[model samples]
Target: MEDFVYFFSFQDPNVAMVVAGITLLSISAAMVGTFTFLDKKALLGDAISHAVLPGVCLAFMFAGSKNPYWIVLGAFITGAISTYAIEWISNSTKLKEDTVIAAVLSVFFGIGILLLTQLQQTGDAALSGLDHFLFGNAISIVYEDLMVYGILALLVIICILVFYKEFKLIIFNPSFAESVGLPVKRLKLLFNTLLVMAVVTGIQAIGVVLMAALLITPPAAARFWSNRLHVILMLAVLFAVLSGIAGAFISFAVPHMPTGPWVVMAISFIAFASFFFAGKKGILSKWYNQRNYQQKIHRDHILKSLFQALEKNSKTLEKDEIMEYFPGKEKLTRTYISKLEQENKIELEGEKLKLTPSGLVEAKRVVRLHRLWELYLAQYLNLAPDHVHDMAEKMEHLLTPELEAKLDASLDYPTQDPHHSKIPRDNDL
Candidate 1:
């Protein structure tokens, strides 16, 4: 608890630097990633992250030390190459984008590993922590390291803000954007540059392997909560910041644990929670809506069945007779009947069931819709009367009052269905 408090207090400059740097990196990755996700180019992030490893190695060779500028330039160059190669292969050949990305990611990453191993053999003290780039050690980020990657992250954020509309246009409808003279090709190139820089910024803190999570997972999870691009971008940034802070704190508190994996783990948990809990699109929401829909269907079926019985004898229905209407679904029918009675749609006198006045009106409305739809289908769709009944059975519960009026007017009042049964109305009730 003390460690957690101290981590947030910023009394220790190193902890503050690492935490602040991570926050900036998160914002950059999330902003760029939202478009990458919308463009269906999520794998581009993964490919660029892996491809930067070779650049890191090449940078070390050129500087003879881990110089931040050389390393970033190298990573960005390699990442840019990987991005363009993916596009070229996809456009020039029959190979899919995923296949090209996979190929580029593997080759570049493997070359990086080979070069890094050679550097390790030299036993230069500067080359000692190069492996940390694969998985991050956030605690190792100092003010200087922060300045190097942090400024790049800030640049990415600025670029995203400046070109937000163009990015949206290209992601959602590039052809339309081009028609409107939006310089789509140039914008794509620029967006790709920002994407590479975002990956580059995170490699030192979040690391190469898991930086893709910081890039894509926040936006992917945010999509569940919103439809608007701007709202989604804000949510993605918020999610990324929270997850980055959590991982950074864990790394600060725990010994020998890298920040990148913990961040990925934190983000993964968040993604799962959003999947099951977000409003409208979540698993729980969908399940609850479906359950309510099913219950409503059962209620409507019971009401219509009781109305049909009333038409037959103009008398109350005994429990056994009502249950007999749905032999295999006796349990369901009984439950729906009890619910309808509580709602005052029906009255239960001992074991007999009778429709209340309101219930009679509702039941008639349901029947009216069923008959009207059947008439329309039989007359206009040329479906046989027998064929129309089954279709109308499903439509009765779904048709709105406005739709019912429209159907009534369109069918010229539809006094009788094709089967010659009278279509009951509120006045008739």
Candidate 2:
């Protein structure tokens, strides 16, 4: 508890600096990553992240230490080169983008690993914390590191905000952007530069290996909760900030844990939760909605069956006769019956069941919709009456009142379906 309080209090200058740097990096990475994700260039971020490792190694060897300026410059140059390589290889060959990204990632990362191994063999004293870049040590972010990374992060964020519309156009509709006299190629190049810079800023705090997760996961999780681009960006930033701070706090409390893995873990958890529990798009929500839809269909089927029987001069049905309609689904049928009774849509007098007035009104609408659709299919689509029944059965429960009206108008408000049965109207009920 004390550790939590002290860590977040920003009371210490070092803690305050770490939080500021990480917050800036998170904002920039999330903003860039949201567009990258929408454009389906996620693997490109992964490739660029791994490709920057060799640059980190080369910078360390040349400078004899981890100078933030040298590291950022080298990392940005190599990351940009990797981005170009991916684009060139993809456009020049028959290879897919993922294949090109995978190849570049493997080759550049392999060279980086080899160079890093050689640097370690040299036994340079300045190499004390060099390995921290692989899996980040956010605790090691000094003033110099913060200055370089923070400034670059701010630049990336500002550019994203300034060119938001252009970026959106290029990402979602590049051909349209070009048609409107927008420099699609230049905007793409600029966005790619900012992408590399965003990844470069995180190489120290979030690490090369796990930085892609920090870039991609927040936006992915945010997407489940929103459809608007701006709202998604804001949510992604919120998620990134939470996970980034949680990772930093874990690093502060733990003896030697890397902040990058923890940050990835935190963000991944958010993604997993979003996948299962987010509204409208989540697994649980979808299941609930599907269940409700199925139940409504079943209830409609029962009501329709009762109404059809009433039309044939049988006002009520024995409960056993109704169960016979749903062979193996007696229990579920009973549940639906109970629900309808509760809603006053149906009445159960002893073992006999019949629709109430409100239920008859609903039943008439359902039957009308089914017959209307069947007539529409038979007349306009030239489908046989037999073929239309099955399709109408599925679509009967899905049409809204407005759609039903439109369908009726399109069909000229017919009185009979393709089968020549009278389509029940409200007066008939």
Candidate 3:
């Protein structure tokens, strides 16, 4: 607790700059990342990230120092080249896009590693921090670094907002956008430029290797929480900002924890947590809904059983006699009957279990649907009468009242099913 307080206390100006810079960088990455994700361009993003390593090394060697401007410029040039190379290779050949991306990523990254190794051997004092672009050192973001990355980040955000409609249309349905006379090709170019910019801005804070995570994880996480594009974008940005801050704090509070992996871990934790607990689409909600549906099926089956017995004898049975129909599940049947009684759907008068008026109506409806479907299948599809019962048993629980009416009309309100079983009517129960 105390460490957290001190971490954000802004008592040191450098910590304050890192936080603000990372926040801006995260927003840019998240916005671009959201678009890239929707367009299924994650591999392209990965390629750009790894490809920037050679640019970073070249910038340091050429500038003879760790100048932020030169490094960012060099990284942008190389990243853009890698992005174009993937597109060119894929377009000019029969090779798949994923394969082209993989090839380009390996080639560029391998060359960058070679250059970085050579530079390290030269023993230049200024090259000591060049490897910071590999795993990231968020604490190293100075005011000058913030000014450069922050402005680039802001430019990305503004471009996205200005061309929101064009970007969205291009990503979701480029052919449609083209048919509608929109400048589909231009929009894609602008989007790709912004994507490269997003990668470059993060090379200092998120690093080259893990930049892809910084770009995609937030959007992937937010997808579980929202269905709308704008809402998802906002949620993604929020998640990214939170993760960036959390990662910085851990690295700042502890001695040697790298910020990039911790940031990925934090956002990944948020994504998994959302996957398990989101209201409509999560694991817990799915389990809860399935359990409710099972209980409903149990209730419907009990009601139908009681109605069938009454049809035969015109009288209710004792609780033990009702158990005769359930076989081996007598204990479960008692629990179900007791619950039905509590819900006022059934009553225990003396020793006899009887359906209430509400129960009778529902039971008649269930039985009617079952009999009607069985008749339709056997009469229309020519299935044997005995073979239809097993299927009707399942379909009876699925037919909505509207569908039941349609079935009745189609069968012309048949009095009996193919097996000569009485199809219970509205007034009979």
Task: Give the least accurate 10-residue stretch of model 3, judged by summed lDDT.
Answer: 314-323
Evaluate model 2: give its TM-score. 0.99
Quantify how close model 1 is to the true structure by its C-alpha RMSD in Å.
Answer: 1.8
lDDT of each: 0.91, 0.94, 0.89
Clash pairs detected, candidate 1: none
Residue-level lDDT of model 1, residues 127-171, one tens digit each, is 878888999878888878899999999999999999998899988
- Comparison by TM-score, 1 against 2, better one: 2
Comparing 2 with 3 on lDDT, the higher-scoring candidate is 2
Ranking by lDDT: 2, 1, 3
lDDT tens readout by residue for model 2, 149-264? 99999999999999999999998899999999999999999999999999999999999999999889999999999999998999999999999999999999998999999999
Regions more than 4 Å wrong, model 2: none
- The window of 10 residues in a row where model 1 has the poorest summed lDDT is 310-319
The true-versus-predicted C-alpha distance at residue 120 of model 2, in Å, is: 1.2
Candidate 3 lDDT for residue 41: 93
TM-scores of all predicted structures: 0.95, 0.99, 0.88
Q: Among these predicted structures, which one has the highest TM-score?
A: 2
